[model samples]
Target: MGSTGERAWLSAGLALLSEQGAPSVTLERLCERMGMSKGAFYHHFGSMPRFRTRLLAHFEAEHTTAIIDAVEAPGGLPARERLTRLMAEAIKNTGPELEIAVRAWAKQDPEAAAVQTRVDATRVDYLRKLCEEAGHATPDMMAKLLYLVLIGGSHVMPPLSPADKHRVYDLLLPLLG
Candidate 1:
């Protein structure tokens, strides 16, 4: 199968995972959502395990790496500006339900847990670098704190609204200077 076919399956999987959690990301559900057959899925992913692995990779690449890349794309932005862009991009690009579902899936799936661990570490490390560049007195601690706020906001009942998230960031960004 072509990359488009593979991406279709991954996209369908992500939608299902976001709407109904990992338990809904079965072959039948994906096939139904994509209007494809088991053969198509197998042709692209070979097996359910492989599909799950690929889905996790897609999630990490889209939700983590892409956000960081976008934030870093413009040369010479101040660290505070980059940090703000990072948070804005994250809130805009990633769905709260999807993030919650992935975290829930990681609780039971070792592969997912490993990916989540790596994503978390990468995000915190990037945040630390930005905080350090911004001259925060305690960059590591600030990074963890900012990351924790974002994670906590996602997991909270009803989740934080995008506007509210920005308000929170507005309140916090001044501390970075």
Candidate 2:
């Protein structure tokens, strides 16, 4: 009925998407999970397509924009420090299952694919800027290298643990010089 209600539905949709992939994010499933009715869903989102659009927007905001905002909040940190903070925030805030699920969803849905492309480009662009600020010889390549590692790591079976991801970043960060 309000923004809070909409957020609850969006959050539940994300959880469902993460656990069971996009196929399971149906109106019936969501309504059943939330103990609400289809009327409630329609009341908030108007239609399933609209809800899916909002859900993807929520994912981008939470998984990308929010992390970038947090990393940039305490300004004046050195480039390397900022990069480290960005990696840390990413590891802490993002769930590998959700990332993989959305990516898989993107493969089949044009809208999801567009969002995924934007998210990947935004992330890589941010990483490239950080690399440039750190004076890396090939900032673009270095950014791709780092981002690829993250994307690759997420798809690995069992996914990389936060500690392990941190170790990987630690090894890579020294190359920024």
The CA lDDT of each predicted structure is: 0.92, 0.94
Q: Could you give candidate 1's per-residue lDDT for residues 68-176 as a string of tens digits? A: 9999999899998999999999888877899999999999999999999999999999999999999999999999988887888898898998888888988988888
Candidate 2 ranges beyond 4 A from true positions = none
Q: Compared with the true structure, what per-residue lDDT tens digits does model 2 show for residues 54-167?
A: 999999999999999999999998889889999999998887899999999999999999999999999999999999999999999999989987888898887899888999
- How many clashes does each candidate structure show, in the order listed? 0, 0
Report lDDT (Cα) of residue 109, candidate 2: 100
Q: Worst ten-residue run, lDDT, model 1?
A: 1-10
